[model samples]
Target: MTRRRRTACILAALGAGVAITQTACGGGTPSAAPSTSYDATVRADSPALYLSLGAGGPKKQKQSAVALKATYHHAPGVTSMPNGDRASLFDGTSQYVEIPDDDRLSVTTTGELTVEAWIRPDALTFAKTDGAGYVNWLGKVSSEEARTEWLARMYSRDNSEARANRISGYVFNEGGGLGAGSYFEDRVRPGEWIHYALVINTREKSDAYPTGYVKVYKNGVLRDQDALDGYDIVPSNTDAPMRIGTAAAKSYFKGAIGKVAVYDSEVPESRLAAHCRAMHGTPREAAGT
Candidate 1:
């Protein structure tokens, strides 16, 4: 209404405009604030590589841990087998080649990682119920018989029939505060080849509400993804051999397995796709439904 008031109002509006522009350019007040950003990136080429094992590749057993190999042949640390076929599981009716110790694989990691393996489970073997039998950090246990393992699965444990045709991942920690983890089936489908992967986050401790986890992918789709909790801290330098098919039970896998790999880090989806593409056979359409 007055000349002075109109002049003051114009100055105020101009000042506000300047302040907003300054803030947008990150030059306003010197407030202590955290900032972040996101970017859309299209990678033309990736430098990452996948770890591969099994069938016609360099052998792991012949190089180190020969004694562990003996365990598979009904012998531990002893290299002699009467059968000319190196080693075989003879269950009276039939005999199939068990996974070789050289090929008995595992990866030692404490940060983050993705592990993929091709398994051909023998018929009639039921996987652990808690899905803890196969993929888990073997913790300190009175014996391998009573170890607490971690796992991931699609169906609810309460569902009576969920375990029937479901695929699951497992982690078991036992002995001296250290542990081992793995992946397995709720029900056994013998003579059929299956591809499985375990993804774990090691940075998050189990107590902090489980930042790490394991996921089971059958074929190409995810079947189960589970968090790691209710377990003790993973022991440092736990270099226990990565045993497939069976764990601690001498419950070895009976059948043909190829392209086994243990990676030092969790694998990404792109890397997983590349891995699946390199291997033989089509990825099964997500296990079960």
Candidate 2:
């Protein structure tokens, strides 16, 4: 069977009354996903890279997008997803997926980009008090060997930046550190599937934000946005691996990562909302679609 012929995600909704519902492949019991698969939304977007955890690996994608097999550290397990599909589960302590970086994976400094995912975090807040009191769930991040580009990070219960359990989208100036950013104010509880997106547009600038702009979204709804002021978000072109469940394999994520997609251009808000609606079992005709 194909890699995508795995277990279905647990979420099943009847209507508005059942706002959130779930099912699981507990005990690692695998189920064959439908032939249509649950990743149609990511595929339809034609991203530079699309990781369908339920579909097995990169080769399973029609584009066969891989120059190397992903390296899984600490062996994150495959488990139930909230979207009626399976996902890669992380342990937060030492579990993550590392992809060899490439130019195709990096966007230009003055370009537009969108990185999105479906995730169910085990904890939105962390115990860490250092490194800005946050952890990177994914990004081309800073490390001793690599300069930073962009990141999708979560704040601790009391971080100096957000001061709450919040999600932040950031773009760095290639020097490999925290740069200009935006964040979502909502508290993300554990075990629930959430659609998270980071959209960056550097071609446009303003007086307050002379560099560009960044947007953060949750469950397809616009949460926050900000201007990039001091620095340009130029990709450092480092050999750092594009990672999930952690940025540089240090700030690990404890949860399940259902799907990941990267677009070279900023994805329109309507499209992101439609994708979110579909995963939520919402009708496609819900205003935007």
Question: Could you tell me which residue pairs clash in candidate 2?
Answer: 4-55, 8-84, 8-85, 9-84, 9-85, 10-23
Question: Which lDDT tens digits does candidate 1 get at residues 1-95?
Answer: 79667545433432231211111111122111112100001011221222222222223343222233312323211110110001122231222
* Predicted candidate 2, C-alpha RMSD: 8.8
Question: Which runs in model 2 stand beyond 4 Å of their true positions?
Answer: 1-38, 55-63, 66-68, 127-130, 158-162, 206-209, 231-235, 282-289
Residue 228 accuracy (lDDT) in model 2: 69
- Candidate that scores best on lDDT: 2
Clash count per candidate:
41, 6
What TM-score against the true fold does each predicted structure earn?
Answer: 0.47, 0.77
Q: For candidate 2, lDDT tens digit of each residue in 1-289?
A: 4433321222232233223433221112212232223357667777777776653333322335544446666667786553345678877787777667766556573277899988777776664323878778898864552577787887777677655767788877667654778887665667667788998877767886576788888766677888766455554555666788888666777777867888888887777765665564432223223
**How well does model 2 score by local distance difference test?**
0.65
**Model 2 TM-score (2 dp):** 0.77
Compared with the true structure, all predictions reach lDDT values of 0.35, 0.65
How far out, in Å, is residue 193 in model 2?
Answer: 1.4
